[model samples]
Target: MTTLRILAAGSLRGVWPDLMAAFHHQTGLTTDTQFGPAGLLRQRIEQGERCDLFASANLHHPATLLQRGLATDTGKFTANSLSLTARRDVVTKNDTWLSLLQRDDLRLATSTPLSDPSGDYTWQLFGKIEQAYPGWGERLKQRARQLVGGIDSLAVPTGELAAQWLIDQKHADLFIGYASYAPRLIHHSHLQVFLIPAPFNIQAEYAWAMLTHSAVPLATFLSSAAAKTILRQHGFT
Candidate 1:
């Protein structure tokens, strides 16, 4: 039996099980997945983690890997968009960010802009909206800083971690996470998902590639038509 080791972004959590089972049962290769932030995963590889496959929420991390001679022959696939998510119970008199940002009692959470693409994209999205709507940028920025005043706050990493915190732990009243994570987001009774307006949200593209340390042929198999079908079935695109 071929054993494949995978390092992937946390956003893939909800769909990973299905993808793994199908890949293994059909190709007879068992996959061991280690999911986390794309940046964190990249750091692991840089630290010499022996992983066969690396799929990231943003292509940047993979690009970094290739630039650093850690990965090779990358392939781009799938896409995602940001959503303004919040707890359902939060009595948002405004509910939407357009209105919520101006409120005083709300707390918002997002991944780290420097380390996580989702966080970076969200910041840009918010900036875009603020540009379109006068007076939004000033208040939004202030509100963000106010919400996360603690020094040891969770510097969110991947899109999935954001959703996980909202649902699994109830860490934040509002957060911006991945589009595909919507189904899982619904599990949070107080969580409600909303899309950021066009020009405000970034168009996410998820990519996959092989690690230089790979000992298994999983990367080659992933590009096969059969594998593509399974990924597409799981909402990869």
Candidate 2:
């Protein structure tokens, strides 16, 4: 049986098993998935990691893959919502990050822009801080610095491990991450998401592509119904 090697974003860690099982059943091609921050995966590919499918957490990541001749565009499959999340304990009395974010003791953690699509969405949110309340971003950032060593915003690893870290360490009052990963964290930890209404929410466009070094048949199969169903079932859309 042929094998399909895929490099995907770490946020999809929760849904990977089902995606692989379904694809294998349909195509009879075994799947090997390498999940991590999109930027880190790109570095591995640049260093000559042989791969078949490229599923990324952001449109730009997939675009970059095709631009550098690393993959073929298969277009975005679905979008994930970005929002602020808090641990259940920290969120009592119907309070949310938007309401308490300006508190002198609050800290908001996000992933590094250097290696995450979620990070880009976080930065975009900072620009729209006024939508929640005027001048909120500056006030939040100032206090965040004194608590977390100094920073305008907080960043954690862009991996599934980071999800556990958030709950284990109680690192910050809130975090910005994809909805897919957020729900899974709740199952295993003390974290919960603050739902940003549609008016203030942002969607992250995700994509799947065919790696240049892959066997054409394997890459082609990723765009087939089997893969699409798997991706969609895992909340790709």
Candidate 3:
């Protein structure tokens, strides 16, 4: 059996193994997957790196691949939203999620925009904040530290959650990242997880692209009930 080549978003790292195992059991086809920032992965594909399937954290990346003729088709498979992870000590008894974000004393960390969908979503959230409160959004954007998910960002230590690790290391007082990570991040005693509320939150739509005819089956499988169940188990919608 030929091994399928897959390029996936780093957000899927914690769940990919379970998903792949299920795929293999159902189809007997194995996969070799590479996980990274979706935008960077898309750049690799555009720069001549071949993959049978490309799973991105956002629909736009795979849709771009389809538009460029690099992919045969693209469709959404799962969804996620943003969350605010903060150092436990920073959150006060009276603080709401919005209050924490507006404080000048806190250091905000986000992924690198344009190189990661998470960063893109964070910026979108900022835009919403700006629309509601004049000048606050711009202040948040100006102060945010783009600490990871760039082409040259520091490598997160093996098996560590980026939000937790960054906070534990004193790199950030608060982090804005995918809510899918909240289940794990919440388990950390020193970290607090806050789901961004509606009207202010951005929904991240994960999309998959078929690079070749051979990848069609896998792509179809990914949209099945079994796959969605696995995704939900991992905190995706």
Which candidate comes out best when scored by TM-score?
3
Clashing residue pairs for model 1: 87-190, 88-190
> Which 10-residue window of candidate 2 scores lowest in summed lDDT?
144-153
- Find the number of clashing residue pairs for candidate 1: 2
Q: Estimate the TM-score of every prediction.
A: 0.79, 0.79, 0.98
Backbone clash count for every predicted candidate, in the order shown: 2, 0, 0
Q: Write the per-residue lDDT of candidate 2 for residues 145-176, one digit (tens) a residue.
A: 22211123344454444545664677666666
Q: Which ranking of candidates, highest lDDT first? A: 3, 1, 2
Q: Candidate 1: which stretches are off by over 4 Å?
A: 91-94, 138-142, 145-161, 167-171, 213-217, 220-236
Model 3, TM vs. native? 0.98
Model 2 RMSD, rounded to 1 decimal: 4.3
What is candidate 1's local distance difference test score? Answer: 0.68
Residue 62 alpha-carbon offset, candidate 1, angstroms: 0.6
Global CA lDDT computed for model 3: 0.94
